[model samples]
Target: MSATYGVPNLEHCIIIAVIHNDGTMHSIGVINLEEFDNAAAVEIFAGRSLDSEEFAIRVVAVADADHAAQGVFALDAITGAAERAGISLLNVIMTPKIAAGQHWTDLRTQEYGILPDPAMTAPAIAAIVDGFGPLPDAEEITRLFTEITPADTDHARTTQRDNPRFGRDTLHEVRKTIVEYLRTYDPDWADGGVIGADFAADERTRLLDNTAEGLAARIGVLVEVSGSARDALLGLAVIDIPTAARIYTHIANQLEGIHRAHMLAVAAVLYHVDGRPFHARDALYRCGLAVLGESGHLSETMPVIGRALLAAARANVETDTARRFLALGPIAARRFGIETPDYDLYPAE
Candidate 1:
């Protein structure tokens, strides 16, 4: 019976039991079920069920009829032992069939509420993650600059050149001086150690990293100025020197704004990582003033100079030209072997 039931090496004391309809039970030496219902349960229990109701009733009747059978009492004891062992005969019979009828998604939902679709969530997560890095490319900067109307540029340039307090030559010289200075100091500027070539290269590789783009935008200002100057010199258009000055001033202001934004973005990243609000506002103000000073406009450039100085002062009180001189005191002393004045000496202000 054990061989037919696939219950190999059955323990002599591990009794099998069955319940019947006649309010009686029977102890069986082995299982001989007509059909298997639950594969998992069957695999767990091996084979152990009555073949049919008729067979169960006959077994119960036979046990009840024989006084010395001991099968009925043994059945009760065996059933009680199985219950105490946490084995469920009915569950073993039906679990596999029930599992086969369920869908994978249904089971997931039942186990864990609603599962999020990866397709819908991935792009949004990527976009949010990408925003923590630098800005877009130089092409975007150029595109935005090109959007400035030519008429507006002309008006600004005219205003700066014709101001009674400022002359065209002064503004022109400012442009020339800056260009020469950049050419002469290119190596020094490159060596300043603020930003390195390798850093720029790494930034360039990442589409969202825009340190190179910021540098490119600064360079683009020179390109625009040169192109405008060439057109003026060639008589391709009526060159309003004052209007040109205003345009140059506007470019300087725009560059300052870009520098400020870039600094703020960098500071934000640093703050996130280090939990320190490093005072970058002053650095930005100083850098912006330096860019404006290099714009090549004279002190008498009135409204334009006044406006730029005001902007600088608002960013940092110490960013005005006088304060700038003070900040450069060390360098001036090194170069001239004397203490430099806290302010510009030539202006006598």
Candidate 2:
């Protein structure tokens, strides 16, 4: 293993690389303390000495003046370990963006800041290249993208419900109505069963398709890529029709405006109150808007459908709506889950 030096108080270090093997380069990112250990182990497993020409390593430190010395020492220790394992050290230094309690937000901002404006008519492909320039392989870029993407389904749902169109009181009434409707319409079906069948399959699909087209119109959006890239991502693989029907029925009961305006309004609300930083909020909102604007309907009602999900996140209030929300996102509703957004649709540039 090779060695480097940095301060001790640094909270986190990320390793970005493109490793070449069998004539192919794979881009990758490693985070957390275990990553360093794994890198060292890899060097040992390869049986190449750090002093030998066959091994190479790079280290980037991130810390402030308070822990600069310790950070340098830590880097040296990391390099020494690699050297002992027979890995050669490459470049190692502190990244400029390092700060206390700054890992999550800073990474998110750095990633989002490079996204191309969706409104741009020319290819936003440049943005993708710029954002991922540090990465050496496609796989690494994909991983980085996933890492930065918002996974807080709970927060997304809360913002949707808080919309004026579907405030807490409204959601309650909607839930009550759905329960009663299910009971009255399907004598043999319980609330869950009715949602799984009648509501999830038919109504939800119609809503999502309509919302997607509507959103596309509102925000002149286009995705650019080779035919192979386009083909790789295009499909209906993510949608669960039955789940969507059931979930939307629950949403209909919870909010008014079964129309495009209502959908966009709900998206805007979700964009604002989800406790995400401003840039993330903007990305999510843009995603929602693009969905509605492109499909001209709720082709993937996950954005709006996700609104009812909040009830499940709250510990004390597990209402029927909440149950339905949780059920919709989980694997059990495999047949009913709504379509997720395509990775390409994300603002990667």
How does candidate 1 score on lDDT?
0.30
Per-prediction TM-score: 0.16, 0.28
Writing each residue's lDDT as its tens digit, candidate 2 over 1-349 gives 0111111233455453333433222343444433455454345336532333533555555545564555455566666666666655545555423332222212212321121222231322342333211113335322322311112233434544455332223223323333443443354555546456656445434543442222222211111111111111111212322232233322322222122223222232222222212222233334345456546564454344334333232542223332232323323212223233332322337
Segments of candidate 2 deviating more than 4 angstroms:
1-55, 95-349
Weakest 10 consecutive residues of candidate 2 by summed lDDT = 220-229
lDDT of 2: 0.34
Off by over 4 Å in 1: 1-145, 148-170, 173-185, 190-349
Every candidate's lDDT: 0.30, 0.34
Output the lDDT of residue 201, model 1: 42
